[model samples]
Target: MILEPFPPALPYDFVFKLARDSHDLEGYHKLRREIFCEEQHVFETDDRDLFDESAMPIVCKSLIAGMEDTVVGVVRIDERSSGLWYGSRLGVSSGFRRLRHISPGVAVRNLQPCYAALGALGAGLIYKAVSTACALGCHEFLATVQQQNARFFQRLHWQPLENIMLHGLPHVLMRADLNHYAAAKKVA
Candidate 1:
């Protein structure tokens, strides 16, 4: 079913579920490599971490066309003792890239606008997950975002609770109050 992919434009149909076991791991890794490594100037190293094995992946299909449909977006959530959280490589594919303010003549930036739309998508999904986590007795939603991406979370009122420097790259430990997430859901 379509759950509002974006404000006025819906690019993909939302699928709130887990990644396929083992068999689909390669897809997730390749996506992370393309969006984070190839598209962005981020590190080319494999983005996998300990949580990858446990994190369940989520996909977005074209709402107009429908999984024979293209997989335009992907994300995975992993729980750390602190609270249930998800992170590491969430991005929109190049094909469905929206052309707007970021669709500058520059080839590389053409897709940034499409990815910008993902903020709305991620917020919708993650907040729902946070609500579920709260029901499961989680107190907060935790995530480690690349320091360069802190602005995205900040748009949703998330705060950087910790500063981390690892492997010569800056990262931030961000926390979202699930209490607020639940309250928002209740209001909705």
Candidate 2:
């Protein structure tokens, strides 16, 4: 009898936290470049800017068998001034973006799922960054999100502030309601 090769193991668990070391930070940047520069063509070479110098990078790591494997998602938060914080460069690895959940009996080959679901990987990354910023004393949190993603942010309790053009693409200036993120201080 012929035996088929087993599919590669998929991560069934994930953890969202601050980038703990250089490796995590590097993965964050690499994922951002993949989504922003290569895939979306938002930036010709790199998406990095001066804000990256002071931004606190948060990462969602996929775990296999209780061990951390890769950064599947990332977002950065930076305090622009006293009580004012901004989030940017949110990205999820293409391979992991469609995963709603992983479990036994779920066919790995058919992993396509909507990322806008409440507990999806991208939502977790955004929540982590916003909560962390709130914990750091952010009274007002803002982000310039791509037009297509504005509704996603809205569902997360972010209010649209205005419209603007950035990197030659339409974007929405949105603000996160701090009340929704107040629990971060307790967890922090």
Candidate 3:
């Protein structure tokens, strides 16, 4: 009889933090390219833009045995003006997006249950970005969310400002209610 090795357990918990080093930054960029370029075809090669120069990259890292494992989610936040901030390039690894089960009561109208799991992860990344911006003196935070995910953002305390076209796709301009997110502790 032949014996097969067991698969490694998937990570259940994740760490949300600012990409602070080369490893984290590399992971951040790699995942963004995978999602935005390869998966969504939003960009032919790279998805980086001028905003990357001043944008702060935030990562959601999966934890394996209490240690950081991989960058499973990513978002970048930047101050566009004196008190206006924006979050962009939000994504989660396709594999990891299915790692969690949707809670009994959580549901998004007209969307699949799987999205609830995605929203859970997205919420963490959004919170980190919003709080970090708040800590940096941001009075307003905004994002251009995909049309399909507009309702999810609305659930997260973001208000739809207007509809816009971006990256050859339909998107909604949304703003986060600063009152919902408290400023995060200062990051080094």
The TM-score leader among the candidates is: 3
Angstrom error at residue 51, model 2: 0.5
lDDT, candidate 2, 1-188, per-residue tens: 99999976668677677886999888888888889999999998899899988888888787776677788888889999998999998888888777766543221221222233454777777777777777778889999999999998998889999999998999999999877764463332
Candidate 3 lDDT tens digits, 36-68: 999999999999999999999999887666677
Instruction: Put down candidate 1 lDDT per residue, 75-155, tens digits, no spaces.
Output: 666667765555546565665444233222211211111233545445544554455455456666777777977887776
Q: Give the Å error, residue 139, model 1.
A: 1.7
Off by over 4 Å in 3: 1-8, 101-118
lDDT of each: 0.55, 0.78, 0.82
TM-score of each model, in listed order? 0.63, 0.85, 0.86
TM-score, predicted candidate 2 vs. hidden true structure: 0.85
* Candidate 1 RMSD to the real structure: 10.2
Q: Evaluate residue 27 in candidate 2 and report its C-alpha lDDT on the 0 to 100 scale.
A: 88
Worst 10 residues of 1 by lDDT: 104-113
lDDT of candidate 1 vs native? 0.55
